[model samples]
Target chain A: MAEASDEQLMLAYRDGDAGAFETLYARHRARLFRFVLRSIKSRASAEELYQDVWMRVIEARATYKPSARFTTWLYTIAHHRMVDHWRRAGLSVVSLDTVDPPAGDPGPQRHAEAREVLTRFAAALETLPPAQREAFLLHEEAGLTAAEIAAATGSNEEAAKSRLRYALAKLKSAVDDG
Target chain B: MADERDPKVSRRYRELGNEEPPPGLDESIVSAARRAAEHPHAPLVTPSGRHRWYFSLGAAAVIVLAVAVTYQMQQEQPDPFATGVSREAVKSPANGRARESAPPAADSSATARPEAATQAETSGRQGAAAPEARMRRDEAAARSLAKPMQAPAVETPQRMLERIVELRKQGKHEEAGQLLAEFKQRYPGYRIPENVVRP
Candidate 1:
C-alpha cells in the first residue's frame, strides 16, 4: 500500500477504499501545507485553505480522472483556492520588482552566521511578487518542472519559467548580499 | 520538463525549514476524506462532458420537433397560389385566358372547384384530366377565407386563472362560473389560487 503511486491511491479511494485516502493525504500533507503556507504568508488562512483543498479532492472523487499527474491536480486545486482567497480579501498580485525588499530579522535564536543567511533568504522570498513566489514555491516544494508549474498555475510554460527564473535570481542576490 | 531550479536557491530554500500544518488540520481533512470515501455520494463528471451530452440531446430533440411541426403545417395548408385562382374566371365560362391557365392548376385540391370539377369530369371522359382533377379546392379556399388567418393563442393554466379573476372582478358571475368549471375540467389537479378561490 505504501509503495502505491499517488494516482493508484486516488483511484482506490474513488472506488470506496477509505484507507487509500488516508495514505494519499499523509503523503502530501506536509509539502502541500508548506506550499499553501508560503503562498498566503498567513498561517490561519493557509491552514483553512489547505483543509478546503483536501475536502475538494474528497468531493471531486466521483469525477476524478487520472488524465494528468495527481500532484498537478492537487496543486491546481490549491492554486484555485488561494486565488479565491485573494479575491475575497480584495487583493491582487502586483509586480514587486521596484518595491524594496524588507529587512531580515536574523533572529538571535540562530547563533550561526549561516543561519542568518537563511533568515535573510526567507525575508527576500516574502518580498517577491505573488506570481513569482508561487512559481518558486511550486518548483522548490512540490518538485514540479517548468511545464508542471504552468499546469498547476494555469499559466503558459514561458511565463512560469520566467517567473521561476526571476525568483531564483532575486533569492540568489539576497544570499550573496548576506 | 527540464530542471531549471538553481542549486544555490534550492539549498537556501531547503534551509528555510520544513513547516508542516498543525496536527489538528491534518486530522480534520483526513477524517473528512475517509468519511466521504466510506459513504460515496456519486461520481463527478467534467462540466464539458456532461453539458455536451445534455446540449446535444436538447438540440437534437428541438430539431426533430421543429421538422415534425413544419411538415404537419405544410401538409394541412393549400397551395398559397390556389387562393389566387380567379373565382370570376371560374364563374364566367367565356374567360378563355382563365380556362387556359386553370388547366395547369398545380395542386390536386384545385380541381375541387365546381367549374374545375366539371372540367375534370369532361377531361376524365377524354382520359386527359391532367390538372383539373380536384373537386373541392374552391370550397376549402372559401372556408379558409371565412376564418381569421392567425390561430388563437393557447390558454395556459396561469392565463386561464387570470381570465377567471378578470371575469369575477367584472361581476359576470354566470360566465365566470362556467369558465371556472371548464378550467377545472381541463386541469384536473391544478391548485386554485387563494384569491381566485375566494368570492
Candidate 2:
C-alpha cells in the first residue's frame, strides 16, 4: 500500500476509487498541515488553509495528470493558497508565538536549552522574507528539491536554492548563538 | 543539488518539520479531503459552441422562407379557378367580323326563342311519316325556317354544362358528376371553373 506512487494513487482516485483518495489524504495530511501551520503560525487559519489545499486537490482530481511529482503540484497549491492568504491579510512578515521546547524526558536544563534554540529558530524563520521562507518550507516540510521548489513557486531553480540557502544560514547562525 | 549552507543545520530543520500539526487538525483535513473526493466537483455546462446557433439560424431561415412562399402564393391567387384564358373575345362576340359567322336566321332563332329548337326537332319526325309526308314537309320546312338553330349538329361545352345543371335540377346529380369526371379526364389540363367542377 505504501509502495504505490503518489501519481498512481491519484490516478486511481481519478477513476473514482474513494479508498485511493483516502490513501492520498493520509499520506499528505500531516506534512501539508504542518506546512500551512508553520507558514501562518495561527492554528485556526492554518486549518482553513489546510482544508482549502485538500479541497483544491479533490477538485482537481478529474483533471489530474502526472506531468510533475504529486508533492510538487500539492505544494504549489499550498504556496498559492498561502500567498492568497497573505495578500488578503495584508501581512508582509508572519508573526509567530514563542516555540515550546521539544517534548521528551530530558532534564530541566536540557529542556531550557532546547526551548532557547527553538525560540531563536522561530524568530529567525519569521525574519526571513516570505519567498525565502516558502522555499525553506518546501524543502524541509514538503521534502521538495530545489527544482521542485522552483516548479512549485514559479521561480528558477537557482532562486529557490538561493532562498533555501539564506533561510538555512539564518537558522544555523541562530542555533549556534542560542 | 549543491547546498551553500551547512548540512547539519538543514538536517536538524528537516527533523523539526517532523513536528506534526495537532492530531484533530490532521483528522479534520483528511476527512474533508476524502469527503470532497467522494462528492466530486459538479461539471460545468458543456459549451454548445456554434452548432446550436447554426441550427437555430437554419430553422429560422426555413420558417421565413415558408412564410414568404405562402404570402407570395396568396398574393398570386386572385381567383382560385382563374385559368388565365382570354374570355374577352367570347364576352364581346359581337365583333365586326360577326357578319361572316353563323347565318342570320339560325343566329336569330338560337338567340331569340330557345324553345323553337324542340318544335323543329318534333317537325322532322312528322316529316318522315308517309301519311302526311308532303303536307308535313311543308310544315316542317316552315318550322325549320323558324327554328333553324336546331338543325346544326354542333354541341358546345357551354350547352353540355347547362344540360348538366338541368340534370342536377331533375335529381340526376350522379349522372352529372360522371359527365364532369369524364370531361376532366378527357381534358386533363383544362382549368374548369370551381362551379363547373363541383356544381
Best by lDDT: 1
Model 2 has an lDDT value of 0.66
Specify the poorest-scoring 10-residue window by lDDT in model 1 chain A.
Answer: A93-102
For A20-125, candidate 2 gives per-residue lDDT tens digits of 8778777887788777877886667887788778777877888999999999999999989998999898433334343444657589888777766766677787
Candidate 1 chain B has its poorest 10 consecutive residues by lDDT at B103-112
Q: Compose the digit string of candidate 2's lDDT tens values, residues B94-194.
A: 44125324332212122223233234346656664433334433443453444444434333556556656766777777877866666565567766666
Q: Candidate 1 recovers what fraction of true contacts?
A: 0.77
- Compared with the true structure, what per-residue lDDT tens digits does model 1 show for residues A65-174? 99989999999999999899987873332112212222366566544566667667877888888889899989888888888889999999999999999998899999
State fnat for each of the candidate structures: 0.77, 0.42
Which CAPRI category fits model 1? Answer: acceptable
- Note the Cα lDDT for every prediction shown: 0.73, 0.66
